[model samples]
Structure formats: C-alpha cells, structure tokens
Target: MKKIVRLISAVICFFQLNVQAEEPKEYTFAINSAVTPLLHAAFINETIKTVERSVAPAKLKVLYVELPELERLIENHQTDFFISTAATIRRYQDLGARDVLTASSPFSKNPNRSEGSLFIVKEGRSDINSISDLKDKRAAAGRPTAFGMYLAAMGEIAADGYDPKTFFKSTQFYGLNRDQIIKDVLDGKADVGILRACYLEDAVNRKVVTTDQLKFINLKNDPEHICLHSTRLYPNWSFGSNPSVPPAVLSAVAAGLIAQKPVGIGLYWSVASDFTAIDNLLKSLQLGSYQRFSKEWFWQRIIEYRFWVLGTLAAFALLLIHSFIVSRTVNIRTQELKESLKRESQSFHEAQEAHRRLMKMQRAAVVGQISSLIAHELNQPLAGIKLYARTLQRAKDSGTLTEDKLGTALAEIRTDADLAAAIVERVRSYAKGARSERVSSEVSELVNKAVREFKRQSGERVEVKLTQAQPVHVIVNPLEFELVIINLLRNAAQALQELGVSNPKVDLTIRRSDNSAMITIEDNGHIEKETIAKLSEPTNSTKADGLGLGLQIVRSIIENHGGKISFSQATSGGLRVEIRLPVQEETK
Candidate 1:
C-alpha cells in the first residue's frame, strides 16, 4: 500500500510539471517602434520573455506599432501590457494603462533618474558650442512625443528662460528613422541632433553611428556612468499594462522583470519607481496630457465643479455689482479731483520751467563773468559744468536722486571738465611755444581702448560690440577721442536701459566710409528720430538733469580735431551717432 501511494505521488508531480510548461498563458506586449529603434525593441522583447504568467510561466506575444497608432491599440485594449519611455508610458496611463516595471541599471543609485538627453553637433560646427548658442538653430529629432529625443533637450532651453517653441529657427521630425537625425547634423541639414542618453555609446558599439565627426555638447559630469548627456537625468523606460489585465499576471510580470539580469549598458528591469519627474517634465513643456488648457478641457472642468463654480461666480457678481455702484457714486468727485490735480500739475510745471530758464540765465551770467580769464569757446561748456555742479549739490541735499542719474550727469561733467582742462593745457603749451600732443592710431586698436574706457567709466551695465573694424589709422589726441566715444556709448546705453530694451546692444563699427575713417555707434534702443536729430542742439537734452550741452561739447572737440559729427535714425530703431575723422596721412 505504501509503494502504490509513492508511485501515484511521483506520477502526479511529473504531470503537474509537464502541464505548467506546455500550457503557458500568452500575454500581448506592445512596443512603440517609432520611438524605439529595432535593436532596442529586440532587447525589450527579450525582457518580456522573463515575465511569468501565474502558475504557468508567461509568454509574451510581441506587437510592434507606430507611436501615433499606439492610442488606437490602447483604446481597443488589444495589448495587455506595453514597454515604452516614461514620457510615452504616461500618455498610455492617461488611456487606461498602469505602469508595472521600470528599466534600471547600476549606474545610478536612484534607478528612476537613469534616462537623460544627449545633444549632438557635428565636430566642425563651432557655432553650436553650448545650449544657449542653439538659438535660431535648426533642430532635428525623432518623434515629437519622445522625451529623450525631443522634449528633454527642449526643456533645457525652456529652463534657460527661452520659449522653446520659437527658440529654434525651425524644427523637423523624423519618424522611425531616428538615426537620420544624427546624419542630418553631420550632413549640414540640421544644426543640432537630439538623441537619448547613452545612444552614442550603444550606436558606436553596434556600428550604427559611425565616424568621429559627431561631438556631444553641454555634457554633464558622468562619473561612473556609461555615457554623456546634456540634460539632468529623468525616469527610465517603463513597462505597464491595460487596466483590464488581471492583477496576478501583472504581479508575475513585475517579479520576472525585477529578477532578470542586466542587459546592454547594464540595463535591466526593476520595481516601479516614481514617475513624478516625467509628469512634471510634461507639465513644464505643456506637452502630452498637460497640453495648454483647451476650451473643451475648461468646459469639462466647469462641468465637474459646476456647483462650486456657480457659487463663486455668484459671489463675484455681487462684488462686481457693488463695485460698479461704488465707482458710479465716486466717478464725478474723482474726475473733479483729477481736474484739480491736473491744474496743480500744470502750474507746477510752468513754475519749474520758469525756474529752469532763470537758472540758465544765472549760469550764463556766472560763466560770462569767469570768461574774462578763459577763452570764449570754453565758456559755454564751463557754464554747463558749473550748472551741473549746482544741480548735483541740490540733488545731494534732496536725497531723492538715483545713482544712474548721478552717474550720467557726473560723466558729462567729467568729459566736459577733461575737455576744458585739456584746452587750457594746450593754450599754456602754446604760450610756452610748444605744439599740442597727438598720435596716429589704428582705428580698430584705438576703438578697443575706447570701449575698455567706456566700460570702466560707465560700469558693465551696457555691452559694447565692436561688430566690424578696419585697420585704417587716424590722428587724434587719444584722451579726447576716447572720452568722446565713451560719452556717446554712455548715452546710447542709457537710452536703451531707460526705454527697457530687451538686450541693450551698442554696435560700434569703424571703417573708411569715404575719404575719412567713419566710426558709427548704433544701438537697439527706442529713442525717437526727432530726439536724435536735436541731441546736439544747445539746451535740447533728453535727461532731466542735463544741460543739453554734452553733445555740443562733443561737437566742439570733434571740430577742433578736424572731424564732423552727425546723427540719424539707426536701422535698429535707435540713435546712430557718426563721427568722421581725417585718416592719418602717413598710415593711409
């Protein structure tokens, strides 16, 4: 009886083992081929084989589908589970798929932050050296929805405070031919190629992306990592299933994935990690399910919160009506108060204008008294200097003045003061029977010196771009000419800052416009042409504390140096101040 029972148990065990292996429940697994290359898809298919199907070890029926058509499959519930990028998985989750496992590696302790973007540029492309340099550059990438291929790189730009949609000159998308983006960059069809992190390493190993012509940009430190990347790491590829899939099967799949050995680049499946990074990335880019709020979505939200929304709106209506009644009651009285204030303002302005005229007269009288000992030509600027000094004293006393206004006013005083001192020194030298000191300098070289002086004097608030320059030489007193350039650059920068130009750019160009060397100072400010035309006219200034004699003094210096100063409307919508000085006879 014992022998019979043992034999029966052995027979049962063998049959059970045979039944488990022979009758495996097959599950359908989906892969988005548009975003996943052939080799990657194959690797993912191998991973699916490790998943278990409850009592019987599960087998996966791999289904390849385009990214755009994945939605159709999810809607029809054709695939039980799917393997895709975290970004795409989120999109599937919105369509009723739940994440089961996430791909991981030994590279990072936090397996979720294993995926990132790699920015590629041709080795010869020096123009695109960094992320910010990608502005107006043509970009090429894989599917629009792929995070590593597109959104990851664009997020870097958005984080830099630029609108990613319009940051690039243009963008092109290549569907399944993802590697073609790399080729596009090398062949000069695209300025940058956005690819997945470790893609270059894997491609080179597989002999896909060939040649040393490609270079990685914005490469972050990858200590103990397999490859270079441009952006911060995000969650890796995710494995998920349809909502209708049985929990037992999902648990088995998760167990199999976590148990599987590491694959390419040490990649293997691990327990599901936080996908909040992916969701946040989508939200930031306004892509995927987080796309810009649409009319339908808004209406859907309203419907969902109809009662609360109605209550809030009713309260808002009551407040608005009350406000309307209050505004009506106070409208006439407010208008009368406004009229009175306007009258007072007009009277105050009239008195201020009269006071300004009186001060001007007083300044002229003081300078005329001092002119007995100085030259007549120097008297006007000397009077302006004294006037500015008195104004500075008054501003200091009032304690309501700003540094910018003070700096600007003081700069004028300094420039004019230096000019007056130089003129007096020259006169003394003439009295001693000596000639004025001057030198011949290359325009490019001298202009550089002038720019340095301008930055030093005006501080670094303004950027001076010497766009183009020629080797032409000119005879000039370096002190006076540089001072003149500094004054003009300061004026241009001030106008741009005051007008709130996005980027205050003062482009300085030096070349032979005609028989003389022309130095053009143009800015991207919004000052009027009418204002620019009268900038050099005496007593016609734009600054509140200005004596309107700065440009007049500039004109005097240029004229004494045998040069002509002129102004015009710049193509950049700002003032264009041009100075033509005689070229040094020998160097020409």
Candidate 2:
C-alpha cells in the first residue's frame, strides 16, 4: 500500500511541474515602428533579457507596431510595457503610465538625455551649410514621427529664421530609418539630410560610411560631452509601464535596468529623464495629446470655465473703451501743440526781420557820425592849401618870387592838397561799408596805424606807447578792424586833450592768451565812472562834442567779427578799452 501511495505522489508532482512550466507569468511590451525590422528585433530581444532577469522565472512578450497602434494599446490598458520616442512616451505618461527607464546614446552630452538632430550634406556642398541655405534645396529626413530626427530638425530650422513648411524646395521622409536619408545625401539625390545625433558615428563605426564623405551643417561645439548636434537636447527614448502593472514588478524592472551594463558603444539604460522639454516640443508642433488642445480647444476650455470667460470679456471691453478715449485725447493735444508751434515759429521769424532792420539803421547812424569827424579833419588841410595858394600868387605879383621860393610854395600847396584828398578817401571808404574778406592779420600792425592816424587827424600832443610781448595774429576783416581801433584811439586822444592833463599819454598793449588775441588801450585822462558804464550804449557820450556812436560802432564791428569789447577804469586814470578777438589756428 505505501509503494502505491509513493507512485501516485510522484505522478502528481510531475503533472504539477509541467503545468507550472507551461503557464509562466506573461507581460506585454509595445514598441513603435520608428526603427527597422532588424533593429526592432534586437531591441525587443534586449528588453526581454532585461525583464526576464528582473522578474526572475517570468516571461515577457513584446508587440512591435507603429506609434498609432502602440498609443491605442496604451489607452486600452493592453500594454504592460512600452518603448518609444519622447512624444509617444508623453502620451503614455498622460494615460497614467509610470516611467521605467530612458535609453542613453553614446553621443549624448548627458547620460540622462539624448542629443538632438544633425544636419548634413555631402563634401563640397558649400551651399547647404545653414538652414537658410537649405531654401529651395532638396532635403531628406526620417519619418515625421521621429522626434530626435525629423521633428527636432524642423524645430532647429524654424529657430534659424525659416519656415520649415515652406523653406525647402522639397522634403522627403525616407521611412522610419536614418540610413536612407544619409544615403540620399551622399548619393547626391538630396542636397541636405537630417538625422538624430550619433547616427553618422554609428554608420562610420559599422564601416557603412566614412566621415570624410559628408559635412555636418550647423555643427555646434560642446566641450562638456563631445557630439554633433544642432537642436536642443531632449529626454531620450523612454520605457514605461502601463498603469495596470503591479508595483512589485515595476520596482524589480527598474532595479534590473539600473544594474545592466552598457550593451555596446556606451549605450545603456538609466533612470528616466525629465520629459518637460519633449512635452514642450510636442505642444509647439501641436502633436500628440497637445494636438487636441489647440486654439479651438482653448476656446472650449474657456466655455467650460464660463465665469473666467465673462471676466476676460468685461476686461477687454473696458480696455478698448479706455484706449479709444486716450487716443482721442492724444489726437486733440497733438493738434493743439502743432498750432502753438506754428505761431511760435512765425513770431520768431518776424523778430529776426525786425532785428535786421534795426541793425541797418544803427549802421546808418554810425556812418553819419564818422562823416562829421572826416569833414572836421579835412577843414584844416583845405584852409592850409588855400593860404599857400594865395601866398604863391602874392609873391608872383610882387616880383619877389625866386625859383627856390616858388618851388617851396608849390611843394607846401601840394602837401596840403594831398592831405585833404587822403581825408576824403578815408571817409568814402568808411561810408561805403564794404564787406571785407576776413584774413589773418597782426593785431600790433592795426594798433600802430590807428595811433598814427589819430595823431595826424587830431594834431594832439599825446604820448602814445605800444607794448607787444609777442606777435599775435587774428582772423579779421582788416579794413573794418582798423576802423574799430581808430575809433577807440581817437576817443582816447580827445578825452586826454579835453582833460587838459599836463602829460597826456595813451598806451596800447597786445598779447596772446590761449586761442585769442587781446588788445588793451588805456589813457591818462579824467573820466567819470558813469561815463565808462554807458560808453558802449548807442547815442550815450561823456564828451560834450562826442556823438557816443564811435564806441557803439566799435563794439558792433568787434562783435560781428566774433570778438568782445569791454571798458574798465584804468589803473593810472581815465578809461581802459579791452578788445578780444579769436586768433587764427594756423598762426598758433
């Protein structure tokens, strides 16, 4: 009986072992069709090995399909695990999927994320160095669903000031693999090609292509971790578990992926990276879940939140009313300001014309005063000439006119006649008011001439001294400047003679200061302080015989030549007149 029981227990144990072996736990993994068939197989095999090791003694069944099918599977809770690009991963995450791990590429700058797309053209293709250069050029890329290659490439192109949809002459999507796009670029079928970063390196390592055959477009230097990339880095392919997955299994799978060594060429699995940038890219492109929540979707949401919508509408209406009121007010003020400016401009022009006429009248008054002085100066010479003529006639009639006497009388008559002519000529030139051209002239020369003319005209016994420290040259209208000096000197001599000083003296000094020439004329004569103050004013004179126009005209002429004239009490006595004129740069 005991032997019979042992046989039955052995038979039951064999059956139990067979049943357990035949019915191992099963987990479904879905992979998108972004990779080639062979690559897809390899990826699946690798994932199976990882999951088998993690959940010991359990089996994993992977279903390879396109992105749309995988998305459906995730939504339907039919997929326990999913491996795909960031965009699809974000869709899965939105459906309550937990991130398991993210794949790390050998060319990634960070192990936690994948590098961006790479733009390339054949060697000697100089015309395709930049995205703008790609305009009207044939280009190739992976499928539009590829985030790391096609979408990323489009993002980079748009960032470089080009519309991806319209910039290129033609854009061809070479299925879901990068190899065909690269081949198209190399074979001259396409002018430019874009692929995920490190694809070229992989091809080169595999001996399928040479680096010398192609040029990288928009290649950026990244010292932190070397790679060829153009767009911003994003989280790499993600492996996530569906919400129905058990917590224990998910924990075990995460631990297993973290423990696995790099498969090849520094490719490994790591803790899932942040998907924020990937979500932003999808939103920007209006893809995946973001596609449904577009501008129209936003309006729907606003309708759902009716209170917020009403508040926004009310605020917008108020803003429009305020803007209208402010614009009207601004327009009214602008018109008023324009009218005011027009009136001000008209007043300014009228004032300018009036000032010009007043200057002309003042000049005429000055000419009148100078004419009087010239007539007075010519009177003596005329009288002398007449007396000499009478003497010569008398000598001839008395028969006492010797040849020597006749010669002496004739010479005296000629001398007086020449003096009268010179006075008349001087007056004529002054009255003409010729606009003399400005030229560089020595200030000392002008002062000496004025002093000599003053003595000759007034016949006053005033001691005049000129002190010049150095030669000073000024830019001036010589004729007008000389008149200015003459007027000042004549006034000084006249004042000295009127004061009746025992030893009347005048001193003229010239010196250079910086870029200016200074002339000072001082006299030793009694003059009141009030007289000095009013010296430059028109028709204001201290002397009973003075017209006071001399000093005023002198001031005007000096000012017109960009010079200044001032009067001060002399250190010794009388008045001191100081004139400052701009010196010529060449002379300095």
- Can you give the TM-score per candidate against the true fold? 0.44, 0.43
- Candidate maximizing TM-score: 1
Candidate 1's TM-score: 0.44
lDDT of 2: 0.73
Tens-place lDDT per residue, model 1, 24-143, is 666777777753432254456567555433324545577778876775676578888776777776765666777777776655556677788888988877777888888899889876
- Which runs in model 1 stand beyond 4 Å of their true positions? 1-26, 34-43, 52-60, 106-109, 206-212, 263-266, 292-588
Candidate 2 residues 505-587, lDDT tens each? Answer: 88889999898899999998877788777885766766676645667667767887899999999988689999999988882
* lDDT for position 145 in model 1: 69
* C-alpha local distance difference test of each model: 0.72, 0.73
